[model samples]
Target: MKLVNIHTLIFILLFIIIGLNTAQAQVWSLQQCIDTAQVHNKNLQMNRNNISIGEQKEKEAKANLIPKITVNADYKYFSNLPYQLMPLSTFNPTAPVGQYKEAQFGVPHNINANLQLSMSLYNPQVYGAIQTTKIASELTELQYLKTEEQIFFEISNLYYNAQILHNQLAFIDSNLINAERLLKNMQLLNEQLLAKGTDVSKVKLQIAQLTNQKESISSKYEQVLNALKFAMGVSIEQKTQIDPNIQFKRANEYTSSTILDIRIIKTQNRLLSSELSTLNKSRFFPSLNIIGIYGTTGFGYDKQPNDFLKFFPIGFAGIQLSYPLFNGTVTQRKINQKQFELQNSELQFGLLTEQNNMQVENAKLQRMVAKKAVETTTEQIELAKTIYEQTVLQQKQGTASLTDVLLADNALREAQQTYLSAVIDYLKADLELKKLTGNISTTK
Candidate 1:
């Protein structure tokens, strides 16, 4: 008896420990999940890399204005050739027409080395390059921001879908519990000769149906959980519960005046406009450059004592002017192409503005409709719950049939689920409004 009691105590303690551990697991909130996803997502990180590359391009644009310097060196050996020398009477006059004195003849070996520096004094190409790179950086930045927005959109939908599945599962669990209770009650009543065998079979069938419903909902819930984990970049081997506190805050709290406008894209378009203006200016302005070179070369015989003549440091400084004189009408065609592109961009921008307006209007209408749905569903749930409680109590008093009680229970569960769905829809619409208006905090 003592050993059996000790074993029972140990078993109870183990059960308690398991329950405590299960209860101690943490539940992640929606914002926390989104933050985790943004931190760990591979594609978002790649977009960030693209942004860094754009910054490097911006650095390159700045570097274009800096001067460039280079060094050059060469060596040569001549065994026998027409050596060069100063204007001296040549002893080899009879040997060749232009041959000089053997002593005055240039050296048979030569080496030349020099350093040269050049800076762009005035070059339209440089200006155009700078402007183009700046625009490219801005465009890349916009693309990164757009990528972030898209991730947020996808994550939000996945998170909400998981929540919806969770609620549906809760409904199924509740229904399953009710069905099991009804089956047990019918079984007991039949044993006491107060219920028919047919009643027991009917309750068993209800339990079976509820079991199938639970299984179906469980499958759907697993699918939704997997999708949510995927969006959050969580591993399949990991297990985590979601917090149900998404209902703690209303969408009104996240809404503000700043959350109602989409002006960033417009700002980018203006930058593009400035870029196009710079490109147009580039077409007419010719480039100006200053070129200067200093070097030394020699070919003489024992003239300067270094196996070569004196390193006559040659230097030339000059200004070069160049312009696109003509190119099969390409320049004019390019200008026309740019004009057409600008027109198309303007039209697209206008269309985007109109679309954004429609989105905002639609979102607002959806939120309003969803709000009404929540209100209506809330009232319906209250009425259904009242009816269910009354019907169940009447059944206990033998004043209502089992079917009436079951119908009332199902109706209440459906109304509750409908309310939850409406609430989720409202929240999603509110998020859409914020996203469309560029109001969501995207710093992460």
Candidate 2:
């Protein structure tokens, strides 16, 4: 008995310590999760890398104007010295007009080396490319911001879902407590001969059902939390919990202005226009480059007293102008294709504006309807709880049957479900509304 008592005491202490640790675990707020994801989410990090890559591309464009220097070298040796033909008249002043002598002209070894440079004096393509990359860099930043908004949207949705599950689990726990209390009361009445055994059985069945419901809800809650943790870019093993409080208020009408999508399209249009301008320039405006080179040619021979190695110096500077006289009309084809794309993009811009306006209106109406449902369901929950309590009291007083109490419990459960549905609808509609208005990026 002494040993059993010591073990029991240790078990109780361990349970208390575990409970304390769980109670102290950090509960992440919605804003906290969003902020953490901004730094850690894999998708967002990739977009940041793309932004850096775009900046490098802009720098590369500017580098086209800088002078380029290169060194070249070559060496060759002839196994059989190459022969050359000389006029026979050089030896015998009037030999035959058709006669000739063969001679070998230089050393068997040869080498050439040079350092050359070319700098652009005026280049339409380089200047035009610089302008295009500037706009492209802006597009890259907008793309990153677009990705950020998408992350915010996903994380917010997961958190809201977790909160809904949390509330449902809370409701199940409340129902379980009520069912257990009723079971105890029915058992007492059965023993005192005031209630039949079937009454006790009904309450037991109710308690079992509530227990099953609680287990299912708890499992769903755990799954939702796991999903939330993944969205936060934290380890699935992380002990993550969302704030149980879901804050919402009726939102006012959102005004429309320039949105990110339109801005991105506008930047794209500018880039296309700049490229077309470059293409047109290529057809007419010529490019000029300043060139400079300094090098030497070497000759080497090895045999007897006349063996020698010699180097000859060479240098020159000049300007080169290039003009594209013609192609198979390829540049014209590109300009035509680009022109069509620009027109389509402009049309898409207007189409998106109209679509966004329609969605904004729809979201506003949905939120208002859900807001009304939430208000109505809240009152229904209160009334249902009151009826449930009165029915329980009546059953205990012998004025109502066990079936009446069960009916009241079912009514209470239905009201609770209706309330949850309304709240979720309101939350989802509000999220959609914020997204449509382009305010999601600015959302906290």
Question: Candidate 1: global Cα-lDDT?
Answer: 0.74
lDDT by residue for model 1 (142-223), tens: 7776777777778777777777777777777777777777788778878988878988887778778877877887788677
Candidate that scores best on lDDT: 2
The C-alpha RMSD of each candidate to the native structure, in angstroms, is 6.2, 4.5
Q: How accurate is candidate 2 locally (lDDT)?
A: 0.89
Which residue pairs come into collision in candidate 1? 105-301, 106-299, 106-300, 106-301, 107-300, 107-301
lDDT per residue (tens digit) for residues 1-444 in model 2? 999999999999999999978876879999999999988888888999999999999999999999999999999998888898999998899798988999888898899999999999998999989999988999999988888887888888888888888888889899989999998998898899999999889888888888888888889888888877777788898778789988877766666567778788888988889998988887789999999989999999888988899999989999999998888899899989989988998998899889888988999999999999999999999999999999999998889998999999999999999998899899889888888887775568
Q: lDDT per model, in order? A: 0.74, 0.89
Best candidate, TM-score: 2
Error of 2 at 22 (Å): 7.5
Candidate 1: lDDT of 413?
80
